[model samples]
Target: MNDIAPQVARRVLLLDGAMGTMIQSHHLDEEAYRWQGITAEGSSEILNLTRPEVIAQIHRSYLEAGADIIETNTFCANRINLLEYGLEDHVDIINRRACRIAREEARDRAYVAGVMGPTNHALSLASKLEDPAFRRFDFNDFHASYLEQALLLIEGGVDLFLIETVFDTLVAKSAIIAALDAMERLSVHVPIMVSVTFSDASRRTLSGQSLASFIETMAPFPLFSLGLNCSTGPEEMIDLIQEMSETSPF
Candidate 1:
């Protein structure tokens, strides 16, 4: 999988469009998939739980749409997110199923990007300081959770790790470190890509760091690629990508 990336580098890679938008198109009434456990019976987000075949069909649709990279339908597969709806136990099952569905559909033509989103726990200074139990916000806890998810994704045969919609730099850093640790433990060397979400008012991440700072912080890591995702829209993202490209060292 790592070798395939270089061969495809000559051409621009096309990632599938928004997953939320696609999910919403199906008319599910759930607030979000994080808590609803798309696989849970009778849950509005049951497409992930009950209608995974439908989800895999969606991946096939994207592939037919000319996407070079197809992300798994497991953005909220981590324990932190699943814990919201008491579905934490299904974390491994959900992530594994997502990768399996994607791999089955993608076969050998497209790349399977294991999708991960931000933690459900807020990372704002105010939130942390207010919670007495917050202590120091242990990176180890974050690392263990992400490592669990990454190992499942890798075991399911994902081609790469796609950490997207990150707002907190600390959490994002922890996730990257967790991914690295997981690779070392599993003895697998797959590429990773990290992206952040931004607010409309400010171009910076939720933590107030500019994209340049985020890129610089992650520069030491062996990232196959990096960019922004799930903020504003394509028009705004295009501007951000252009700005990032001009300033980015890579």
Candidate 2:
């Protein structure tokens, strides 16, 4: 994987649209995701190992569509999220395989951004508003899980890391740190792009942090870019994104 900073600095880069949505269009059944006689239906990450061709096809389509970047199908591939389906132990293989599939299809046509999604749990949010401090997982847990995922993603040859669709600033912070830590340990470096989601026009993270706070919280890191992703349509997000550009130093 090479540093994309120069190219990113030159012009606006186009990233492919939703991977899960495109996968759903195929309407694959439980058998498509089955591996080792165990069926983990709806887990797209497993498709990299069991059905690499399918993942490859999706990458090809996006590249053919003029996307400068195609994300590896590894979102929610982390141990914490995979535990719900009992596929936690297969995290490394799944992530590595996903990158291989994406890299093969990309083949110098586009950069492969390793997609690390926010896990199902949050470090701050709880079921009730009153229990603001109550969390099922802690910061260290998030960091460790992200570290394991980041290490293999780097080993698998991702051009950059996309810690995207973050709902919790705390979670994004953990991922950012883990990615940097992974690079230090492996003696390899790649740019990281962070994209957060605003719950609404309120312009606040789901965990209740204001956009300014989110920018302030992430300011210390040498991020490749900071922007918005899910949670609203373009018309609704334009102002927020413009505000981000004005407020963010990235």
Candidate 3:
């Protein structure tokens, strides 16, 4: 199947707005849904687990909102995050359901962006530069977790993968590599998009890398698109986009 993302990226793609904001508007209560799988009997996270219909409805709302790309609710659907809620066994189910819901909601009107957010693991520059000792976790563990999610999303017929809200470039690199590796393994030629969240003050990723450095570091990857998302208002995001447009290879 031909990938539609390359064409979309060439234009000014309109990604859906803040997910947390939209969810909050639902008044599900933050602590309740945030800790869903573990605390609440059928936590809001379990919406994918129990009420996938509701999830699809949310996706449809974004499409109606004029979003060219609608991300799946699987942002925190990875094994690590699921495990926190004692729902590790539901990782595959949750991710796959998320993709299915998004696909159903799009109805060919919009593209489904399989969402992958940062892992619960802590990321620090000293940890990245410090070698094995500084690092608190093993690379294999990290790769396996992400690879599982990416593979499932692809299998579920997601149009593209979006690695977003990344802070440390090192961790972001791990996610990028994992997704690429999964695509290679599955022989699925889906496009991948990587977006990092910047700190409020300097507008740089948590690893202290400038936008230029981030672009340079991610240049080798076969990314169909690269941009910033989350943790910034429209004005800051606009400036960051302009800076990236000037510096990025495009």
The per-prediction CA RMSD against the true structure, in angstroms, equals 3.4, 1.5, 3.4
- After superposition, which runs of candidate 1 have C-alpha atoms over 4 Å from their true positions? 29-46, 128-137
Q: Please estimate how well model 2 matches the true structure, expressed as its whole-model Cα lDDT.
A: 0.89
Top-TM-score candidate index: 2
The numbered model that scores best in lDDT is: 2
Q: Residues 177-228, candidate 3: write the lDDT tens digits.
A: 8899988999878888888889886877776788888899989888878888
What is the Å distance of residue 82 in model 2 from its true position?
A: 0.7
Taking all chains together, each candidate's TM-score versus the true structure is 0.87, 0.95, 0.87
Candidate 3 local accuracy as lDDT? 0.76
* Candidate 3 root-mean-square deviation in Å: 3.4
**Model 3: per-residue Cα lDDT at residue 105:** 80
Model 1 agreement with the true structure over 1-250: per-residue lDDT tens digits: 4355785668778888777677657775434333443334332222466567678878888999999889988777777766665677887777877888888888888888888777656544334656645634466777777889988888988888999998887788788888888899989898888888887847887778888888888788888777888778788888789988897765
Count of clashing residue pairs in every prediction = 3, 0, 1
The stretch of ten residues in a row with the least summed lDDT in candidate 2 is: 124-133
Give stretches of model 3 more than 4 Å off: 9-11, 29-44, 123-136
